[model samples]
Target: MLPPFTEETARLKVQLAEDAWNSKDPARVALAYAEDSEWRNRDVFLDGRDEIVGFLTGKWERELGYRLLKELWAYTGDRIAVRFEYEYHDTEGQWFRAYGNENWEFDERGLMRRRYAGINELPITADERRVAV
Candidate 1:
């Protein structure tokens, strides 16, 4: 059940999430979620792996040069919370830094069953970007 995660395990899980997202591969990232996983990303509501893949595909397409960092906020039982910041540029090369918090729930096999994220984006100059892809 990968439940009751220790500090080390929780941190590892957070890093895994960060790495998966940074890969910008829809199929690879979808592997981390259950077949019927549910997600609320920004204003979009999605259910199932297919939807998740589609959502991420469109997201990465528009958010070019994406780089992400995620930190473990808290964990209990089969659930975890994380705070993350990501830097990306739009099609026109307008840079932005996005800050968000995600609450995740895992199934018995340690595949995520649910994810909820609230995000805010701030405009940033190219010279202000601190994250490197």
Candidate 2:
């Protein structure tokens, strides 16, 4: 059986993901994965950090003005699960909230070796998604 995860580890992993997303830097985010990491995001399967970086770069380019928040769902040993919500504006200024869950498995060296993500998008009204100043 896999070992239990400490609360601290779970929190840290979530924080790392959040920071990486906020940075909007694909290269930086890709470094968090192992050299030959495997990933399935939505329906696309990608392997290796280069592909991860390329995918993220294309994603951010198309999904402009992206911002995200992730919450820890569960954890076991070196694997962690999380659910996330994100808001982004498409090329045409239409706003959407994307809800998703991810399963992540890290190797012995704390580098993520595998990731599986499921995502869906929903349209949001301007008032519903507005940020108060």
Candidate 3:
């Protein structure tokens, strides 16, 4: 699962990420990243796996019923770009659909070394929710 990925491998990588995030397991998801991974998630910047785990923990706590879908937009060398959508509801029961894109750089070991993401959210009624989870 090193870099220079083929189409099949790239798709696999995307699917794996989607699954990990959907699991809502911070530690599990963090395992895919390097020890000193760097990330720009929305407006916040994070460094290292510890920060990733903490961020995800808080995120999942705030975003109930989180469900994510990610597609591989492109891949070259050790870089991958993804387009993603996710749905979640806040504690107040207001639902939201988030659309985003992420650029990821991987180390030789296939661990993500850097990630940059931009995201926007739209309010939605419960009836508008598409993902079952």
Give the poorly placed runs of model 2, Cα more than 4 Å off: 1-4, 130-133
Judging by lDDT, tell me the better candidate of 1 and 3: 3
Each candidate's lDDT (Cα)? Answer: 0.93, 0.87, 0.96
Candidate 1 lDDT over 63-94, as tens digits, reads 99999999999999899999999999999999
TM-score for all models, in order of appearance: 0.96, 0.92, 0.98
Model 1 residue 38 CA deviation in Å: 0.8
Better of 1 and 2 by lDDT: 1
**Highest lDDT scorer:** 3
Residue-level lDDT of model 2, residues 8-56, one tens digit each, is 8778878888989888999999988999999999999999999999999
Tell me how far the alpha carbon of residue 23 in candidate 3 is from the true structure, in angstroms, after superposition: 0.4
Report the C-alpha lDDT of model 3 over 1-133, residue by residue, as the tens digit.
Answer: 8898888888999999999999999999999999999999999999999999999999999999999999999999899999999999999999999999999999999999999999999999999998767
| C-alpha lDDT of candidate 3 relative to the true structure | 0.96
